[model samples]
Target: MRVLAGLIVASLLAAAPAQAQTVFAPDDPGSSGQPGGWVNDQWNFLPGTGVDAPRAWGNLIAKGRPGGIGVRVAVLDTGLAYADRGRFRRSPDISRFRLARGRDFCPHAGPGEDPCDGEDAYPDDPNGHGTHVASTIGEATANAIGVTGLAYGATLLPIKVLDRDGYGDQQSITAGIRYAVAHGAQIINLSFEFGTLVSSARQIPLVLSAVKHARRRGVLVVAAAGNAAQARVAYPAALPGVVSVGAVTEDGCLADYSDSGPGLDIVAPGGGDDALRPGEPQCRPGVALRPIVQMTYAGSKHRFGLPRDYVGTSMAAPHVSAAAALVIASGILGPKPTPQALEQRLKATARDAGPPGPDQAYGAGILDAGAATAP
Candidate 1:
C-alpha cells in the first residue's frame, strides 16, 4: 500500500551536535556557496534528532569503504530511475551509483483482449516512489549535485514489484523477494505494506515463504510498518525474521501516522506531525514537521527535483537497510555477518526513545547509524 504524501512547511532550526573529527563537506550547487547545503534540508541526517550520518560516514571512510562499498541493497517498490530506456531517464543524483540488473514484475496491459506480459529486464520507474526510496539508500555523495545517500558506495538492485500506482499483488512481491536473494543482494528493502485488514500470516503464505527464503539465504529483509496510525503493524513487516520499522518525526517522537505494536523492531525519521502522547515533550499534535527530502521526479519521470511531500514508514525502512549495509561494510561484525547478528547490532546501538526499554511506539529506539557503525 502507498502512504499518501504530505506537505512540510517548517524548516529545522536546531543546530546539529558536534560532528566527528573526520569532516565530509561536499559542495552543494543550489545553496549559494553554503558548503554541504544538504545539511540544511536533510535534517534526517543531523546529529541530535536524526540518525547522525556524518559520524557513520567517517567510520566507513576510516575503514576505507567510504559508504558501504561491496554491499548490495535491493529496493522492491514501483521500479526506479536507475536507467535510461525509451522515454525514461535516470535521476541525476544517482547517475553514478553501481546499479545491478533489475527486473520489471509490473504487468503491462495489452490492447483489446491480449494476454498481459508481467516480466521484463528494464525496470524504469513510471511512478516516483521507487526512485525516491532508492535515492535515500544509495544516491551519490560528494558529487556536488544534491543530497547525499546513507550508503552511497553500496550497489543498488531495483526490483519492481509494485506498479505505477504503488500497488502490487502477492505473486509479484514474492517473486521480487526471491529474485533479490538469488541475484546476490545482501539486503532487501520492502517499503510497501499490505492493508491492515490482512492481519493473519495465513493470508499471505507465499510472501511469508519468500521472506523466510531470504532469511535462510543470509539476506537481511527490512520492511515498513504500515502508515495506518493504529496499534497493529502490517503483514510482511510483522512476519518473523523481517526487521519491522516504525516512523518518527524530527522531534524524535513517534510520528502521528506511524503504526506501533509488539511487532515493531525500530524507528527512524519518517517526517510528519507528532503523535499526541501524555508526558512526552516532543509530541506536538498539530505541528507539521519537515518531510524527508531527496532527489526524485518533479512531475514526470523525465524531470527531477527535491520534493518535500514524501513521508511514512516507507521513508523510514530504507534508513535501516542502508545502515545494515554500512554495518556489513564497516568490518566490525567480521567478514560475513548473519542476518540475526546484523539486526541485533542495529537494535543494540539505537538510541532509546518513548516509554523506555523497547516499547511498541519507538521499538528498540530511533535508528542511530553513527552508533551502529562506530569503530
Candidate 2:
C-alpha cells in the first residue's frame, strides 16, 4: 500500500509540469478615441465610463507652460487595451507605449507566463480597467483615434501586476513596484487597493524603501486611498513618503466614498453627476446596479459590443497621477521634490473645496492642474 501511494504522488507531481501557463500582451488600441477637450459637453474623466471627452487634465495641461512633455510615467494596473472608439486620442510620434512587464499572482486563474511566454511579449488587457486608466495618463493624442490624455505628450510604460480580476498578492505587487522603478519610469501610478492592514504594515518597509529608492533616482510614486469610503486607509497609498490621493465631485465637493485623513494628500475631480441629469438615473442598459455617480471604467468591450460604466475610488486615483506628471514636466518645482514638498505645493496651489484650509473632509483642496503648472 505504501509503494502504491508513493507511485500516485509521483504521478501527480510529474503531471503538474505539463499544465499550460497563462500569458498576456499589449495590443494596438482601437482607432476611435476622445480628443481631450470635452465629450458630450461634459468630461468623461473616470476609467471605463467610455464616453471619451476632454478630461479636466486637459484644461490643466493647456494652462501649463509645457509639463510632462518629455517624461515617462509608468501605469501599474491590470493591463492595457487600446479601444475602438476615440475614448483616448492617439499620437504616433510623442505617445510611445510598450507592454514592458507583467505577472499573474492568481494561481487559480492560469499559468503565469504571458510576457515571458514569447507567445505574447506585450500584456493586453481584456478587463479594460487598465486601458482606461492608461489612456487618461498617457494615451497617444491628436491621432484622431481616441480621447485626449492628461499628459498627452508624455510616454507611457505599461506594467501588469494585477490579474484580469483586478486583484494581486503582496509579493506580486511588490515585484511590480520594483520593476517600474528599475525601468526608466520616473512617475509610478498605482490605482488598486488591498484590504489587509497588518499586511500593509508589514509591507511598509519595502514600500518606503522603494519610494526612497525611486526618489533617489528622481522617480515619484503616486497611489490611491482605498475605495472603502471608510476612514480606514490601504497599503502603499497609506505608507509614509508616498502621495495618497482622494476623490471629489465636479462642483468641487468631497466624494462620499473617498477616504479622508492626514494620509489624504490632495483631492481631485474623481467623478460626479454632472454628466447625467439629476433625476435621469445613470443606467447602462444591461447593468442592474447603476452607479449613483459614475467614476471608474466599466470595461473596454461589452457582450453587445459596446463600452460599460465604471465607478469607484479606483477611478479617482489616476487624475492625481496625471497631475503629478504635469508638476514634474513643468520644471517649476525642482527636480525630485520630496513627497511632503510635492504635497505642499499641490495643496498650496489647489482650488479650495472644503472649509477654508485643510480639513479632514477635503484635505487641502481639489487638484488644480493649471495652478500646479503655472510659473
Candidate 3:
C-alpha cells in the first residue's frame, strides 16, 4: 500500500453542543437548526488559538460575498461524501454547499475489491479523510448542524486521487492535479503527502511536474508538510511554488506530529498534542489536545458523525486553501490575483508564532483568516 503523509489515529464519537454564542450569522439558515453551536466545537476558528474565522466572515459579509463566493477549491484526496448514491450519504452539514461533479482518478476492478470504483460519475468519499478536508475548506457556515467551513461560499471540486484505504500512487495524484487546473479550480488543497522516506522531489517527477503546471496556470496549491515529526518536510508540499503548511495545536504551538523544515510556508490548527517547547506556556507536552472536528463518516460511509481523531498537516492544508479562496473573493488583490500574491498575503497577514521571525516549525506563523481578508 502507498503511504499517506497524514496520520489517522483511532476516533471517538463526539456531539456538538446545542447552544453557544453566535459570532456571525449568515443570512441563509442551514439545513440543521443550531447555527450558533459551531462556536462551541470549532476552537480552530476562535480568535487566538485558531484561525479567527468570525472576523473573516464579517469581512466577507460586508463585501457581499459571505464565504469566499465564486472561488473553486479542488480537494485532492480520497473521495468525499459529497453525493448520496447507493449506500453513501452526504454529511448533513456539508450538504448545503455547492459542489462540482468531481472525477475519480483512481479506478479499480470491482466494487467489492475497492471502495472507490471507477464506475461512479461523482467522486464519492469512501474514506472519511477527503470529506473531512473538504468540509474544513467549504463545509457550510451558519448552517446549524455540525461545524462551519472557512470558505463555505466557495465551490468545492472533489478530486479522488487516493483509495478508501487512504493510499494512492503518483500517477493518480498527478492526474488529479492536472484535472483540477484544467477544470478552473482556483485553489487546490493537497492534504496528503508522500512518505518522509521518499524525500527527494527527483523521486516523484510526474507529481512535481503536475504541481508546477498548476502553479503556471495560476492555481494555488496548498499542501500538508507531513506528519512524520521529521526535520525535513515531505514531497509535493516541499516542492517550490506550493504553499507548504504545518500543523499547530489548540495551544498555538506546533503539533507534536507535524513535520518541519525548509520550504514550509505556513501553519494552521491541526489539533492534537503540543510539541515540547521550553518557555512557551502553550506547549504542554503529553497533554492530549482536542483534534480538529468536522462532520465525517463514523465508521461506515452510511453513518455521519464528528470524529475527534483527525489530526495532522493534512488537516492544516485545507485551512490555507480556504483562506486563499477568501482572499480571492475579497478583492484585496484584485479579481484575478496570481497564486504568488495570494500566498504572500496569507503569509504576511498570518499571526507570528515560534521564535521572532518565520521559523521552520511554524513557517510564516498560524493562519489568521480574519486578517488575511480584512478590507
Candidate 4:
C-alpha cells in the first residue's frame, strides 16, 4: 500500500505575461516586477518579507561573472520538462540552468508512461510534480518572463525516481540517492515523501541507508514534511541527516495542512487556498493565501499569461534547497564547507517565526533567503 496520497489541488489562478505593472488583479496573469505577485514580491526582490533570492542574484551578477554555475542540485522526483520550441515540444528548465544530463532510474514504459527498467539512464517527468519542484529551485531568473527561482545560477541534476502516479518504491528512491551522491549533487531535494514510517529498519532500511550515504559524502538532503494534517513527522524527513520542511502561510502562521513533529527543520510559504479541498472553507480571492508560483508543465502547453497554483510542503523544500545553492554560490561559507557546516548556517540564520526559537511547528523558523545568502 502507498504510504501517502497526493495533496488536494489548490485554487489555481492563471496569469498571462503582460506588460510590467504593480496591479494584483486576477485579470492580470502577472509580470515579474510586481509586489502583489508573491513570486515577484515576497519570494523574490522585494525586501524584508521576501525570501531574498534576488539579493543573492544581485550580489553575484554585480561581480560580472555568473555564480552557482558549479553547484549541482539533484531533483529526485517525477522528471523535468520545462517546455518546447521548433523541433522540441518540451525542454526542461534544468537545461536553462545549464545542468548536465542526470540519470533516470525508470526505463521508458512506452509512450506517455514512466516505469522502472533494468537500465540506469534517462529521466523525464511526464507527471508535472518534478518539473514544478525544479522550477522553484532554478527556473531561470530576471529574464523579463516567468517568476524566478532562489538559485537560478545553480545547475540541476534531475533524477526521475517517481513515475506518473507520484509514487516511487524504496528501492528506486535509495538508488536515486546513491546516484546523486556519486554523480556529485551537493544538495538533494526530496519533495515527495512516504507517510507513517513505523520503524526505519523495518520499513525503509535502504532509504535510511541512502540518506546516511549522502551525509557521509557531505551532501545535504532536504525533504518535505508531508502534507498530512495529522501533526506527525514522515519518513526520510524524520530520518537523521535530512532537513525536514513544512509549509506556512504568507502571514507566517503554520499552514492548515502542514505536518509537524520533533525533527522538522523549518517552514516556508507553501500557499494554502482552502477552496482546493472539497467541503473545506473557501477563502475569498484576495483574502486567501497565494500559492507559490513557477513555470512548469500545466498539461496545457506553455500558457504564459496565467499564474499556475501549486501549494504544499513540496513547494517549500526547494526554496530551502535553492537557498543552500545560494549559500554555496555566495562563497560566504568558504570554497568547500562541510555539509554539517552548511546545514548549521541554514538553521542558525533562519528567521524565527513561532515560540521564539526552534519550535517543532516552524523548526528553526521560516527560511531567510536574504540572511542565508547575505555577504
Candidate 5:
C-alpha cells in the first residue's frame, strides 16, 4: 500500500516535492544513507506468533513435497541488482532470470544514473527499494548473507516500471502488467502503486482490458492497497478484478496508517503506524492478506550512511507473492488458478482476523501462508 506522514492531504500537497517526503524510496534500501543489511534481516516478528501452520501454499515448498521443485515468479518493481549477486547464488538454478523487454517511461530527474532502462538498457537503482522488494521474493536465503526469501528456491523475473523516485504513470504500469503476463509470470506482484484513480470511460477500457487479459492468462494479480490511511482509494489495487491489500501490525491489529475501504480484498502485515516497540500485542488474526512480519537490524546504514528503520506494505506483498509460488509449485493448484478461484481459496481459508468475521477493516481475513496451501 502507501505510507503517510500523518499530514493533511492539503498540507502534504502544499509542501514542496522535496519537503513532501515520501518514505518509500524504491531506488534506496530505505536506510537514510549507508548500506543496509540483508532484506529479510529487517522482517519484524511477534514473539510466540508466526506464520499459520498447514500453509497450503508454503507447505508445497517443503522438502520432498510434490511439486516442491523450483517455481518461477515475476517481480515487477524497479529492477534487480547485481551487487546482491550473493543473494541469487542460493537458487538451484540461477539461469532462469529474464530481463524486461519493456521501455522505461520515467524521465531522468537529476544528475544521477537513469534508474529506468531503455531498449533493453539496464538502469542502476540509486535508491534500492526495488532491489529490496525483489530480494524479499526470491533472494537466495540460507546462502548465509542476505535474509531468506519466502520462496528461496523460486525463480524471479525482474520488471522495472518505476524510476528512482518510485513514481510511474498508468501507461508504464499497464505495459509492465502485459509484459509480465506474456513473459510467463504466473503470479504478478505489484508492490508499487499510484495515487490516482482510473475514472475516465476511455481509460476504463484500458484497465479492464488488462485485467481481463490477466485472468484469461490464468495470472493472479496481487496489489497493495494505498498506504494513505483514508478510506479513499488508489488505482490498480482499487481497479476492478484486482486484489487490494492492507497492512497489519506485529500483533495482528489493523495498522492505523493502513487504508481501509470496500475496495480492500485482503490485508497483510504492512507494519504499524507507530514503531512496534516491545510489549505491544503481536499481530492478531484478522482480515489481513498473508502477514509479513517486520524486519529490523541494529545500526544499519543506507547508501548515503543515514540510519533509520525500514518498514511498509511493500514488504508484505512479496510474502504473498512468494507464497503463491509455493502453492503453484505444489502441483495440487495446477498450472494457474483463475484469479477469482485463487482469491476465493485464499480468503475462505485465511484465519479470521478482525471482528470475528470479514469487515472492511480486515477484508477476508489475515493471510495464512501455511493454511492457504491446504488442498
Candidate 6:
C-alpha cells in the first residue's frame, strides 16, 4: 500500500505545472500588435503571468476563421463613441463584426420609472468606463491600428446603462439587460456593479427579472464582483446565475482591491495598484499594469489618449467575457451552446489556481482560453 501511494503522489507531482515561474513581457505582440497595451502585455500570455490564460490561445484563433464573428456581446455600461476621437471608434476599424444599434436607459424620472430620458440617438461613452470595457471585449486586434482584444472578431453593442457620472439605478440596468436579451445578444458584459451588497428580492424585481430573462433567452451575463477589498461580493454579481469575476495582478495572485466570496466564478488580469511578487517592480510602467489596459476615453491629458487604463474587477470581468466570446466563436463547443453549457466549459477548462478545486479567490481557476477552445 505504501509503495502504491508513493507512486500515485509522484505521478501527481510530475503532472503539476510550475507554480512560481518567472513572467516577462513578450518581445513583440505581433507585426500588427503594438506595445504598451494591456492585452499586448506579457500578462495576457505565458504560463506564470498573472491569471495564467496565455495569448497563445490565439494561435488557434489564427489557424481557423475568426470565431467571434456574428457573436454579439453587449457592453452594459457607459457606452462607446460613434465617431473616431483619438484611436478608438465603433465603426470602420472595429467594423469587422456588425454592431447592433444600442439605447440609453438613464432615468430622468427617478430610480425605476418609464419616463426616462435617453441620451443620444446613438451610444457614446463620455465617462470612458464603457468604452474601455467594450474595447477589451473586442478592439480590432492585429489590424495594424492600435491595441489588441482577446476576441476581436466579436461584435459590440453599446447599451448605455450608466450615466456620465458612472452611476446608474436598478431600472436602467434592468432595462439594459432586457434590451440586450430581446435584441439577440449572445453575451452581456456587465462590468459595473453596486458599491454595496444588495439583496436580490422582489423589491429589486426589475434587475433580478432582467437577469433571469437573459438566462432564459440563453444570453451569458458576465459581471464584476466589485472593488471592496473584502470578502463580500456586491449585487448583480451576488445574484444567482451571473458569471461573477474577481481581479488579479500580473503575478498570479488576487489584487488587493478585488472583492471575493460566494459569487466569484473566476479571475483575470485586472492588474494591481502596487503589485508585489518575487523579482517584479513595485509599480508597472506609468500606472500601467496597476490598471489593466484598454482603449477608452480620457477627458484630457491621459495615457493612450482614447486608449487608457483602469484598475478594478471591471477590467477583469470583460477579459472573461472576451474569453467566452472566443469560445463561442471558435465553434469548439458546438454551433449554438446554451449559456449554461458555455459557462460549464469555462469552469471545466480553467487553469486551477490558488487552493485546489474551487475557492472564492480564484474560483474554478484563472480562465484558460487555449484549453477551453482546444479540440
Of the candidates shown, which would achieve the greatest lDDT relative to the real structure? Answer: 1
Residue lDDT tens for model 5, 1-375:
221111111100111223222111111222222233332223331111223322332355343442224555666666545332322222221223423332333444445644443424443343455555655566543332323345556667666667655765555566767877887777787775555444232554565577678878888887777666767444566777777777666556667656677877777666544322234344333323222322211232122221123346566566667666666666555665666777787777665665668887778877765556655
What's the TM-score of each model vs. the native?
Answer: 0.93, 0.69, 0.92, 0.81, 0.71, 0.79
| Tens-place lDDT digits, model 2, residues 32-58 | 223432232223332223211223334
Please give, for residues 1-375, the per-residue lDDT of candidate 3 as tens digits: 254737547312123225442236443322233546566567897777788787788788888887999999999988888766788888887754488878989867464554457634578887889999999999876655677789999999999888888878788889899999999999999998788668778888898899999989999999999988988888778988889999999889999888898788899999889998887887999987888888888877798877877889988999999999999998999989999999999999998997988988888999999889987
Candidate 6 residue 317 Cα shift, in angstroms, is: 0.7
Clashing pairs in 1: none
Global lDDT of model 2 = 0.52
Q: Model 2: runs farther than 4 Å from truth?
A: 1-67, 82-121, 196-200, 203-205, 272-308, 335-340
- Worst 10-residue lDDT window for candidate 5 reads 5-14
User: Model 1 compared with the native: what TM-score?
Assistant: 0.93
Highest TM-score model number: 1
The alpha-carbon deviation from the true structure for residue 239 of candidate 2, after best TM-score superposition, in angstroms, is 0.4
Per-residue lDDT of 301 in model 6:
21
Candidates' RMSD to native = 3.0, 14.9, 4.9, 6.8, 11.3, 10.4
Give the range where candidate 1 is weakest over 10 consecutive residues by summed lDDT: 1-10
Candidate 4's displacement at residue 37, Å, is 7.4
True lDDT of residue 222, candidate 4: 92
What local distance difference test score does each model get? 0.85, 0.52, 0.84, 0.68, 0.53, 0.66
**What tens digits encode model 6's per-residue C-alpha lDDT throughout 114-160?**
33357544666656677667777777655545555666677888898
Candidate 5 at residue 171, lDDT? Answer: 57
